[model samples]
Target: MPAVLGIEVKLDPKWSIVSTPLFEAYWFTDGLNSGRRDELYSVDVGLRYSFASNLSLTNTVLYEGRTSNVAIRHYRDLRIGPRLDFAF
Candidate 1:
C-alpha cells in the first residue's frame, strides 16, 4: 500500500451504508503463463424498516467481471436479490 499526505472534507446531513465492498478474483496457470479468468466485486444496498414488529427485507445487486493488469477486458455478469420477512 502507498500513502501520502492528503486531506478531505465531509458534508452530509443523513448518511447510511447498506453495502460493503468485497472483491474476489481467480487465476489460471498451465505450467507457465498465469492468467486471470474470473474477477468479481459484490455489494449490497438497501434499507430496513419495521412493519409492525420484527420484520425486515433486503435487496442487493452484484457485479462480476474479467480483468487483467493492463485492461479490465470484457465483463458480462449481472445479479439481483430481493427478499421479504414476516414475524408471527
Candidate 2:
C-alpha cells in the first residue's frame, strides 16, 4: 500500500509569497516484500515581484529527500532558481 500526505499555505497573494510542505511514502504489501518501504519529503517556497504590468521576476526554492530499501543509495537535494516573465 502507498500513501501520500501534504500541506500548503499562502501567506499573501498580493506579493506572491507561498509555502508548501509534502510527504510521500510507499509500502510493499506482499509477503516477501512486506515491511519494505520508501519515503520522500519535500518543501517548496516561492515569491514573485512585479516590475511592471508586463514584466515580473519570480524565485523558487525546493528541498527534497528520498529513501528506499529498494534502491542502492538514498539522496537529498536542494534546488533554487529564478524566472522572468514578459509580454510584448
Candidate 3:
C-alpha cells in the first residue's frame, strides 16, 4: 500500500512574508507486519523579494522530521537558505 498527503498555506501572496507547511506518509505491504512505515512532516516560513518582473529571491527556514522503524533509524533536520529564481 502507498499513501501521501500534504498541504501548503501561503499567509498572503501580496505580502513578502509567507509560510508553507507540508506533510507526507508512506506505507508498504510489510508496514503492519515489519513496521517499515515512514512519515515526513515539514514547515517552511520565508520572505520573498522581487527585484524585477522575472527575478526574485526567497529566504526561508525549514523544520523537518523523518520517522521510520527503529531499525531504519529516525532523525530530524533543520535547514535555512535562500532561493533565487529568474525567468526571461
Candidate 4:
C-alpha cells in the first residue's frame, strides 16, 4: 500500500517543474493478489530541454531495485542509456 502526493511550480513562462509520488505493486493476474510475478513502478524525475520549437528532449532519472536487493531472484538497478529524436 502507498500514499501519493504531488506539486506544481512554475519558474517562468517557458519553464516549469511537476512532481509526483511513484510506487510499484506486484501481483498475479491469475487471481486476487496471487503474488507470483513482480513489476516495477519506480519513482522518477525528468528534465525537459527545448532547443527549438520543433525539437526538444526529455531527460529522466529513476530509482529501481538493485540486484543485491533481490532475495529470491536476480535483479539489477534500473538504468537508462539515452534518447534522442530529430524532427524535420
Off by over 4 Å in 3: 1-15, 30-35
| Candidate 3 residue-wise lDDT, 51-76, digit = tens | 77688788889898888765455889
Local distance difference test, each candidate: 0.50, 0.74, 0.71, 0.52
Q: Give lDDT tens digits, candidate 4, residues 1-88.
A: 4445654465664444544555554546576435565544455565545566556565656565522233564454655443443688
Go through the candidates in order and give the clash count of each: 0, 0, 0, 1
Model 1 stretches astray by more than 4 angstroms: 1-17, 31-37, 50-55, 68-73, 78-81, 84-88
True-vs-predicted CA distance for residue 24, candidate 2, Å: 0.6
Badly placed stretches (over 4 Å) of model 2 are 1-13, 30-35, 49-58, 71-73, 83-88
lDDT digits (tens) for residues 7-87 of candidate 1: 222223222224545666656666443664555555445443444455655465655555555365556576787657588
Assess the local accuracy of residue 88 in candidate 3 as a C-alpha lDDT between 0 and 100: 82
Ranking by lDDT: 2, 3, 4, 1
Scanning candidate 1 in windows of ten residues, the lowest lDDT window is 1-10
Q: What lDDT score goes with residue 39 in model 2?
A: 86
- Residue 55, model 1: Cα distance from true site in angstroms: 6.3
- Report the C-alpha lDDT of model 2 over 1-88, residue by residue, as the tens digit: 3344434343454356655677888787889778778888888787877677688676889898989996754789999998797978
Using lDDT as the yardstick, the better of models 2 and 4 is 2
Per-model root-mean-square deviation over C-alphas: 8.7, 5.5, 4.6, 5.6
